[model samples]
Target chain A: MDRMLSADEIVRGLLAKEFSAAEVFRSSLERVRRMDPALSAMLSVTEEAGMAAARAVDECVARGEDPGPLAGVPVVLKDNMCYRAAPTTCGSRMLERWTPPYDAAVVTALEGAGAVILGKTNMDEFAMGGSTEYSAFGPASNPWDPDRVPGGSSGGSAVAVAAGYVPVALGSDTGGSIRQPASYCGVYGMKPTYGLVSRRGLVAFASSLDQIGPFARTAADLARMLSVIAAPDPGDGTSSRRARPEYGAAVASASLKGRKIAVVRELAGMKASLSPDVEGTLARVLDLCRREGAEIVEVSLPRSLEFGLPCYYILAPAEASSNLARFDGVRYGFSRKERTLKALYERTRGEGFGPEVKRRILTGTYVLSSGYYDAYYLTAQKVRQLMKEEFRKAFASCDLIALPTAPTPAFRKGELVDDPIQMYLADIFTLPVNLAGLPALSLNGGFTADARPLPVGVQLIAPQWGEEGLLSAAAVLERHLGPASVAPMAAVKGGDGR
Target chain B: MTVSERDVRHVAELARLHVEDDEIVGLVGHFTGIMAHFNALARAGEEGRLPLDDLSPVVFAHDEIPPLRADEVVESSVGRAVLDAAPDAREGFFVVPRIMEGDE
Candidate 1:
């Protein structure tokens, strides 16, 4: 019943009869009841559903059949991911009451693996913003400091794991959604290579850039989750049909003995605006890589510096504008009364969508509109190609490119809530990878001097369909740097009565 | 850096969003600020490049198919939760206001 157990440890414990699934479930539920109110990490806790699933897992264990790899392990899913019985709101009022008739492909895989579904975590509205401040429900607080924000749109998933609410959770990364939050919250997050995981039931933000990933306390746990979910789904047209790798076994074999790691020169000093604490932590990570026999090379991605963000904004929104058009009050989601069909479309969308969602939709509409299509949307696509080409060149020289996940540590809630541009700039270092559809991971590099737990995440980027190389590099770094020590907030708050 | 009210209205219409007159001014200011930062993408100098579509996996042509399943089964799994949010629904189907006179 100890909180902060890795998902692998929890599964092993349950299998060995160390604790019943019901006992583990109860402990997680208790943790949520005590901690979630302050953290605001979860949008909805599936108490009844979770207990039911746990009981089923216990029964399977008693029957002497292998349940699954992650059997009996509690995990939180980002609210944007569709779950059969849970309301997948995407942290927006637009789909506040929308419930999918079926589970997302990842959910099916996780459930099939016998993982206990704890709840749906909160996120930015439609996973658009870097911070969860854009979430209609409200921002999730970083576990390290209550006043600071947990970097998001995967903030809730990251916080849930960082706070020990769950050992692992599913999060979707379009533009640094998974990695930024992982860095800010001081945990490991991986955005698998695009097409590696199915996006069938995910509420699409940017179809091309979006990929479901996992947040975990350690690399091994992340590998275990990846192995279960990283498989092609026929339902997802964009999903990869490539052979799946044994991620868990690969993690054990990950070694940097002769690995060529590249540090993108453009991104190295781009975080000049970051606090010195974060800068120093990143420096130490580089030092650790050198000590591990990793040959660090400085590679320049000139096109990436200029084109990545622009291409992302244009392409992502254009796709989003189309994907979101489905929620016009006819098929599903919030509706509004109006006399005319046009009025219904307007009123329903206006009433349902939040300010940020509306803004992006408008931007998207403008870019994709007939007159501006060539000038904005088409031009951005071309830029996206150049960005991808630049990445191709960089990969030829090195196995991975290291960079900071976010420009700074977690800022306080409401700090950039009023200013959308300031919030967007937070993903300066992490967006390009998504734009190029590359595999990237963020691990705990080091902490700041203030003891606020500034997580300096080194992003290891590999070519598309190169998840094996990406996870392997991350595993080496995780072992070399050592596991991050995070004190449970429950003990700090005196709530555990320890 | 000033986003005119007319620009805001035009964009709102294009986006299919209905904004109140009072909210327009505030929204214009927010848009202006966001656009200012978005302009950074322009300076990033990535013009004349190809769009993401060029890199897309090839879509094979499909052969002719037989008659599809009846609509009834397709509509069965859609639950009350999805239907309840619809603006108009009757007899387990989404109902819409008349788009044209004499239209069924």
Candidate 2:
């Protein structure tokens, strides 16, 4: 069973002349070619461009020049993250043929670090849905069980890493897009502190909540990739200038000695809401922390968890409605032929966007409407502030907070597609962190009791700019979890019979 | 608060999405189901009624002032390519339906 090499192994091997960077890239694309038809994880594969990038790395090595830290590593981009002149569909007809004029800050960073850009991966239409079912292209199949969903709107990126297609892929977390899907697909996904990574070329979903991060099979890869993309960018107004702790060094020197991790009273009381699998996974992770001499104290976040989803729904859509207005036919998205100007605007958007995208745009407009503005949007914002305060007090007693990444494991596809609320509920655990502009790392904690492997994820939430804390904890957890469990038949499973 | 089909229609109009009659049936039900959750938020349960602070909205979570770049005219390499992507384009602008029904 050939597995994709971890980023560290690939870099070391490339330098050691074990294989050329081209071979590593070709191997990755070969696996994509072998498996992606059924999985539908990829929207496009930039084979020629990727090969050219690989050649550059190999030439650097051949000429006795230093290849960068992530040399030969292949990265898949969540389609919403722009790559210059590539179709960044974001799984919608609206941007079907649209190519971004510039590369996203993350893309530029990855290329600078010598990572090969494989191509754009599928996502929910404008990253609206929990499952990739909302993807206009198609649902990305869960690696563990083909019948289940690869939780999205970063589903394709997660599946790519989980199925051993690539070592690293980038996903944006606005609400729980990155973390929940990583939990479902059995990988590590981080939503770095809001301003830690630049949002320069990321098509904005919810500006405040959105942060670009990586999905990887190992915590080491998570840290290494984070180091590359987490630099302050002049291009993004929100990119913070605060000095960042060396992320790679944090993972390398990960320790649990005297680390005070808080278990929130709010999470403890919600045993009934958590699955048996999730409960067991959290308990085991806590036990491991305890064994490592980390103190686990109980703290209270009160209604923070309960109000998180409601607050997120109100605020994200309100922000999305404004950000997505650029898609009018007059600008650069999907234009159409129409008799009247108003009809052109309406018909172009109607025909271009999928059902889920339209639903969100409408919902966003409804939330921002004059009558409902104060009642819904304003209240949600106020609640968001209170939630942030509760977390501030909780962090007073501990170094970081721990919780289940999702309420459950990867749900069977079509199980909740018709139920929009149920789909939104999939992100219940992960959204609270986003609302607070906190850093969270979702990593594979344990597996289910099935005769086969179904991975469960546990998250560590840290205060603003606390990515170092999350990385250290994740590095320790990865050692105990053995290695990420790649689904045996991941290549063959499709949610909707692809 | 109850949401009517008329409300959804108005929202869709504001959003510039012309949804069909059949789609509206599902859209109405979907919006209603979601609002039911918001309705739960409205209900002041023990969890919702917890002593919360009367805090203002923290719009941008980070407080650091954004660093501004020096204004400079940088030629875009993809300007022509962007124009080429338009469904209809002429003279450095995206073309769309004429403003009037009976005009050039």
Candidate 3:
């Protein structure tokens, strides 16, 4: 009944008959009820459905059948992911009451692996912003400091794992949504290689950049979730058909010895931009790598470091504008009454979308418009091509690349919410990987020296389809840095709910 | 790098999202600031700073094109579910505003 036990540990305990899956699920549900009031992490909690799933696992165990790899572990999904049992709000009022008739591919995979569906977690509206403050329902608080913001658009999913409501949760990262929040909330999160996991039912943000990943407190739990969800789905044409190795087994035997980890020389020039805690954490992580016999080398990524942010802002919004056009108040989401179709479309969108969403859509329309297409959108794409080539060359000299997940740790809520450009700068470190479609992990490198000790994440980037190596290195770091810890506030705040 | 209110309104119209007259000035400022950041890419391209030769836009994650599945129709019971989710539907069809005034 320990809420803090990892998904792998819970599976082992269930197998050993130490506790029924039903007991473990109820404990997690109870924890969510207790902790989520202050965290504001969950948009909705599916008690009946989750309990039914748990009992099904117990029945399998009673009948002498294997209950599957995840076996009775409770987990949550970012609301951007569709689930038939709960409404997929995507943290936007536009789709506030809309229920998807199908489950996301990851949802189906998790359920098939016997992971209980705890319900949908909150996110930035349509996953547009770096802070969850853009969520129409209100921002999810960072568990480390209630006054601070959890780095987002997957803020709620990160908080769920950090507060120990669940061992793992699925989050989709377009531009560091998963990894940045994982860093702020002090947990391990991975954005798998693009196309490795199916995007069958994930609400599209930026099609080429969006990827589904996991947040967990331990490397093994992250690996277990990845192994369960990473597979070829015929339903998703973009899903990779490349053979995937068993990630759980890969991490179990992982070693850091003889691996060459690269430190970007371009990042050194921007040292002034990094907060002291993040800079110190990155240095300490390199030191840990050296001590473990992994060689740390320097690589230059001039184009990527210089132009990644602008390139991503242009390209992601362009795709998002096209993807979100389907929500024009006619089919399944919010709609308005109008005499003319055009007026209905305009009124519905203008009223339904929040400020950030409208801003991006407008920006997207401008960039792709008649006068500016070549100068902005096409130029950004060419820059992206150069960035990809730069990464390809860097990977030739090194096994993996290292960087800070964000420029700083968690900032106070409302600090950057008003400044769109400043808020976009927060993702400077994490954008290049997504542009190149590479896999990356954010591990809690260390905490800031503040009274509350906000977490700073050290990011490790792997080459395409290099999750095996990425998870292995993360496992080694977990041993040296100590595993991710739940925020202390999860136990103290929100007690009024209980 | 300056976005006039006219340009903001034009873009909003193209995007099919109505913008209030009050919000146009703020949106113009947002666009100006965003465009200022994007100028770095344009300058880099114009100056030939990064090697932009013979490179194509990466539309897919991988270099190889994704394999296509067999294009065949399959029966599904999702018709009822789809209808149930629609804001306005009748007799298995979506309801919409009148497209033609005199034809009906």
Candidate 4:
């Protein structure tokens, strides 16, 4: 079995009687067992449950019943996304043993489509940090190089797809968690417009900015998974009531013959100190788009230059502070016995959360506290609104905005762990899209000469509710980029073919 | 301005987190640097605007639920597992320290 096969390939193969769903699943399980030890991508493996589900799919196919769109396809859920049988730890020891009584809305959707649940992938604790280094379980290593960090919070999901462990996996993007890892892992990851996917069972990081998206090797597979998962949910109030479009069909027919693409002029030169490899790859992607008949325009988004991160720091943590307060050891998650109620709450939280999560919670609480609300949280909200308006104007002039996903490629592990500011700055190019609740995608553009596969992703931001257009453009770009080889970790480990 | 250790401790208490005394110094330095980033927002005028306080409502409005028939509501067998994992529990209720005198 090849390390990477698209979801469509797996489904078609299962239907054609070439192999049973159990066989495909065994291969995936074997791959994860071999690769994940080195990659540290998965937090928990649902081997027994996954095999049972795969057998059920095979039985359905045997009876001549259709097993939905993604029938027999195995996918991993980010640990933050709740699954019935899997522990949704959210990469923190606070809820290390917490299991959801019910499946998250996305899990239900994927299950309904006959997708097999592989297991839970790792992430940063409470999705707070940019690198998976903040995970209490331990950092998820980049598939390209074991020594480097996987761009995070959704790093495991990205690495799972990159290493060919799973063709597609679910990831939640709050301030570029999905896109950054996708860029780092050299795969396609999309952060759909906020509220496009339901957030009912997701452990909330930042309620307003968080959205469930998927990572895959191809645009078509991402689109297919998106179509299955993106729909309004009665359980979530913020979920969009808009009708889900045929994303896969849209991708199949996407053409860039007359499309107008814009490169954010301000963001282009903003990271002037980027490594020569990354800069060269980005330039080549621009040239490829121009060659493919896209009319490129230069535009300015000055408001996003400084205000995005500050606004995010205030808004996300403030929301997170409130959302995470429910885990005080009373109703669910970690707890400690104490003589006083206040002490119980304090000790439970202190013992539960990791260092990064605690830092953000404290920052959030401080900003939202009485004396600082007006000076910090309130002002940040206003600036967020301004940034949204600026994006609205920028989109009017161009069909999509393009920029590098990260200022630099994946850095060595522990490189930015000490310097919190440097780590936060890594999301500079990708956060503005989330702040505006716009749909954006990261695709493998080009690579560095070191054969290290420096992934340069051009982000395409569309107006809210314009995921169809954004995806169509991404499909065109993916096709033009050609099929890039994924360097699977299993192969690097010198594992013999199973 | 340098954030004092007192401020860090105060923030940690408000956040409902316990921090060691030695860690307070590092946290103070981190918060001081983070607050400097907030300085940019000071220039933006936000006098009368409300913060995102209304983002989370105490209760969601919904249609009245019909009474469940005994057969319609299946009690989960996993309830035992859940309670078993609880750090503090007594009988069916999650055990908590006595809030009122003589409650225990």
Tell me the tens digit of each residue's lDDT in model 4 across A133-250. 9999999988777777879989999888888888999999999999999988888889998878899889898887898899988888888999999987767877766678878887
Write model 2 residue lDDT over A345-416, tens digit each, in one string: 888888888887777788889888987787677778778888888889889989989889999998888898
What would the TM-scores of all predictions be? 0.91, 0.95, 0.98, 0.92
Q: Go through the candidates in order and give each one's DockQ.
A: 0.32, 0.56, 0.69, 0.28
- Report, for all candidates in order, the number of backbone clashes: 4, 0, 0, 0
Per-residue alpha-carbon lDDT of model 3 for A1-498, expressed as tens digits?
A: 553899989999999899998898889888888778888999999989999999999999989899999999999999999998999999998999999998889999999999999989989999999879999999999888888888899999999999889999999999999999999999999999999999999999999999999999999999999999999988888888888888988788988899999999988789889898999999999999899889999999987888899999999999888998999888868998888889889999999999999999998888899978988898988888888888999999999999999999999998999888899999988899999999999999998888778889999999999998889999888888888998775333633323
Cα lDDT, model 3, residue A238: 84
- The numbered model that scores best in lDDT is 3
Error of 3 at A132 (Å): 0.6
* Top candidate when judged by TM-score against the true structure: 3
Which regions of candidate 1 are displaced past 4 Å?
Answer: A268-271, A490-498, B1-3, B34-87, B101-104
- Of the two candidates 2 and 3, the one with more favorable TM-score, higher being better, is 3
Ranking by TM-score: 3, 2, 4, 1
lDDT of 3: 0.90
**For model 3, how does the per-residue alpha-carbon lDDT over B21-60 read when each residue is reduced to its tens digit?**
8888789889989998788788787787866666687778
lDDT of 3 at A145: 85
Q: For model 3, which pairs clash? A: none
lDDT per residue (tens digit) for residues A1-498 in model 1: 554688788888888988888888889889889888888999988989889999999999999889899999999999999997689999998878777777899999999999999999989999989878889988888877777888899999998888888889999999999999998888889998878899988999888789999998888888899999999776777776778878887688887777778877765556566767666667777777778888888889876766666667777788888888887878777888777778888999988888888878877876787766765676666666667777888888887787777777878778988777678778877788887778888888776665444455656677777777777766777776766445467533544533
